[model samples]
Target: MAAKRILLLAGDFVEDYEIMVPFQMLTMVGHTVHAVSPGKAAGDQIATAIHDFEGHQTYTEKRGHNFTLNAAYADVKEADYDALLIPGGRAPEQLGTDASVLDLVRAFAAAGKPIAAVCHGPQLLAAAGVIAGRKISAYPACRAEVILAGADYATLPMDGAVTDGPFVTGPAWPAHPAWIAQFLTLLGTRIEP
Candidate 1:
């Protein structure tokens, strides 16, 4: 398979597994994954949050590992990458408000490049105004936002994933296996068993 250059959008309080797993897994499969966050440079770290469902009304948050970024956000050019990966977490709440981040998402969308967003990552897409008329699957709590953005919000199992045109989304981290698999396919990557 041809090596693809993937851009990952992340920020402080990003989900630990959501960012780390995809970064490592995609790189292991011969892709060059550059992870970046606004105002952060290479070697800069973002604190991650671990969300666990321990019979609570909502998932509980805990401090997670610090994730070292490999790329600087200011240095990224949308044309240099084959696809974009947006991981879900509290980060999206802030990332959605960045003009640069929204512009980046718009560039990927206009280019028809594959874009993968899991959990709250779609919040960025909504903020960028790119999901209109697309079918999206995100964390259940995001249903109203997804619908308000003019996308069809799909109610999916916790481990479910959905792909509509150039966009791929999942409910949350548990859907990573399927989410990544679908995205790899979109990137024209073949993993031989």
Candidate 2:
């Protein structure tokens, strides 16, 4: 299959595994993944956060590796990429409210591009008003938003991922294998070992 050019939305405090793993794994398989964030240019670095479940009501967050941006957010156009990836973390809480971010997401949705979002990443899709009638899984905390947006909140295991049409979603980083694999399917990426 031909390689897909994916635009990944990232920012300060994004989930460490959500961003890093997909970028690395997708690239390893010959996909072109562009990591970008608003107000940041190529070569700039954004701090990451590691969220772990240590038997708590919610996950605990700790400082994580600094991820360098390989593309400038200002230069991205939905027409240039075959798919969109949004990683969850504290970053989505803020990024979800950004007008430009929502617009870009809407564009991708309007064009029926494949979108893979994890955890709170669905927050962006909800805010963009594009998830209506879709079944999407996100961190449990985002259930209300998903439902309120006229979409079904997919209830799944921590390592589970769900694909509905061109959208693929999962609860957290643990769902990487399932989530990414499903996304690859949507991108028509075939990995033959």
Candidate 3:
């Protein structure tokens, strides 16, 4: 398959694994993944957060590596990319409120391009008003928001993923293998084992 240009939406406090794994995996498979964050420019970095389950009521958060942005959000042209990826973390909560981020997501949805959102990532999709009537999987706590956005939500195992048309979603980073594989299929990418 020809190399595909993929757009990755991220911000400060984005999930460490969610953002890094896919970015690295896609690049390894010959895809050009551009990581961008609103109000940030190329070479700028966003602090990442590591979320782990430790028998707590909710996941615990720890400081993670500072992820560098490869592109400037203000310069992104959604039409130039073949797919969109949104990683879950505290970033989406604020990114979802940004008009630019929402517009970027809407453009991808409008073009029928593949979109992958994991964990809290769907919050941005809901904010963009693109998940209505679609089926998706997200962090369990995001269930209400997903339903409120008119999407049918499913709770999947941590390592599971679901694909509905151009949308691929998963519960968390643990679902990376499945989530990313499904997305690559949608983007017409093939990787040999």
Summing lDDT over every window of 10 consecutive residues in candidate 1, give the lowest-scoring window. Answer: 51-60
Output the lDDT of residue 64, model 1.
96
> lDDT value for candidate 1?
0.95
> What lDDT score is found at residue 107 in candidate 1?
99
User: Residue by residue across 17-135, what tens digits does model 2's lDDT show?
Assistant: 99999999999999999999999999999999999999999999999999999999999999999999999998888898789999999999999999999999999999889999999
Please report, in order, the local distance difference test score of every candidate based on alpha carbons.
0.95, 0.96, 0.95
Candidate 3, 74-159: lDDT as tens digits: 89998899999999999999998899889889999999999999999999999999999999999999999999999999889989
Each candidate: RMSD: 0.6, 0.6, 0.7
> Which tens-of-lDDT digit does each residue in 3-121 have in candidate 1?
99999999999999999999999999899999999999999999999987789787888999999999999999999999999999899989999999999999999999999999999
Q: In model 2, which residue pairs have backbone atoms overlapping below 3 Å?
A: none
TM-score of each: 0.99, 0.99, 0.98
Which stretches in model 3 have alpha-carbon errors above 4 Å?
none
Query: What is the TM-score of candidate 3?
Result: 0.98
Itemize residue pairs with steric clashes in candidate 3: none
